[model samples]
Target: MVRVVVVDDEPMVCGFLRTILGSAADVEVVGEAYDGAAGVEAVRRSGPDVVLMDLRMPGMDGLTAIEHINRLPDPPHIVVLTTFDADQYVLRALRAGATGFLVKSTPPEELIGLVRTAARGHTVLSPSAARRLVAASTDSLSARDRAREVVASLTEREIQVLAGLGEGLSNARIAARLHLSEATVKGYVSRTLDKLGCVNRTQAGLIAHDAGIVEP
Candidate 1:
């Protein structure tokens, strides 16, 4: 089952999601919080599969929470919640490593489905959010195109390892999933990182995300 935590300053919003999420047979609402700090604490303690994060909370807003989640060993997927017109916060949240963005007014019926999709490592961006990302980060194409060109020089095995890492799989997990030895996966990961000119998995992930090649 997909476990979720909902973080919103408004108590009603939290209750509403709890009700709707309760109706999803494969999903469970594991926790709720009124601010980003409390939300971060809840995530550390509850270990939910996903977090529905509101970007406008009073203290240490959702973007801050995302940074903390990124530091975690096995972070929960985060989907920043915002009003559609709040383009600035949406982009900030995405750059902070949120897997998706959802409008606060999204129908309760669709919320659970989107949450499920995000928990499985898929990203969500509304049409307006997509447009905003394209506009705000048009420069990404130039950098992304250059990065892809460099990455294309990787050997097939290195490419596979890089793709697995882009999907957030640990080296051991990648080895088991790909039917390879752990040491081999680690070696491939090192070579892939060097070939792509990326120092860490996050940078490589950003490239993969910008290039739209790694889904789930």
Candidate 2:
């Protein structure tokens, strides 16, 4: 089962997430919290496989919570809950160790799929979100040049795999698209992340966008 925690300031939002996630046979809402501090506690208490974290909250915000959770041993995958317009916060959250972000208005089935994707240690990025991130990034042309230079060092297959990640394709989907085994795709993903010195797949995906490997 994929255990999950929902952290939102509003009780109704938390309850709604609980209901939607609970309806899935393979998913369980293990805990809920109203703020960043409590959210961190909930994660520690439940040891869930995934966390749906709201970026804005009273007292402590989602970004701080994500950082705190990341410091925990064997941290769970954190997918920020946002309006999708908050590009800065979303990008900061990803940099602080969130696996990805989900627009609050995402379809129920798609939300479940994204949660499962994050649980499997894959990035849960949307093309639209990535585009916004790329546009909002303060990185100048020099940064883009650096990103491209770093990408050039990768093998052609690894670059393809990274582009798959830029498109938010999971390992299974990337494998099918490339006509390679899922295990091979997984290895390439690992090597690519290591080569880029990225903390997570989300960072690498963002780099792929900056590098123009997959247009944002």
Candidate 3:
């Protein structure tokens, strides 16, 4: 089973998420928290595989909670499921080690899928959230230039793999698109992440976007 913890300031939101996630036989909502401090505590207590977190709260806030949770030994994967998809929020969450950024407006089925994806150690982002990040990239010339420099250090094959990541394609999908073995694609992804100084696929994907490989 994929154990999960839901963290939102609204009790209704937490209950709603529990209901939605409960429908899946493979998923279990193990804990819920109404604020960031409690969210971190819940994570420590439950040791869940994934955490669905909200941004605005009475104290600590989602970004701070994410950083705190990330510092835990063998921390769970966190996905920010907030109503806000602002550029700064997205960047902050990801930079703090969130495995995904998703707005509450995401479809129920898609949200469930994203939770599962995070449990598997892959990056997730709502389509609209991704577009916002891409837009933010265009507004910052320095970020774009730095991204290009990073890309320049990569091989052509690694660049192709990164483009696939920016497009939100899984390893199997990227392999088929590039006509390479999935194992080969996985190696390329690891190398790309290393070259870009990224901790996860989401960061590499953002770099790909900033570099104009996936385009806005």
* Number of the predicted model whose lDDT against the real structure is largest: 2
lDDT of 3: 0.86
Per-residue lDDT over 11-44 for candidate 2, one digit per residue giving the tens place of the 0 to 100 score: 9999989999889999999999999999999999
Alpha-carbon lDDT, every model: 0.77, 0.88, 0.86
Give the local distance difference test score of model 2: 0.88
TM-score of each: 0.67, 0.85, 0.87
**Which structure is stronger by lDDT: 2 or 3?**
2
Cα-based lDDT at residue 29, candidate 2: 96
Task: Indicate whether candidate 1 or candidate 3 has the larger TM-score.
Answer: 3
- The local lDDT score (0 to 100) that residue 190 gets in candidate 2 is 92
User: Which stretches of model 1 miss by more than 4 angstroms?
Assistant: 126-128, 137-216
Q: Taking the tens digit of each residue's C-alpha lDDT, what string does model 1 give over 1-216?
A: 999999999999999989999998999999999999999999998999999999888978888988887788888888888876447667667666787788888988888889887876655654344444545664666856865787778887777776676666678888998899999887887777677765455445555555555552
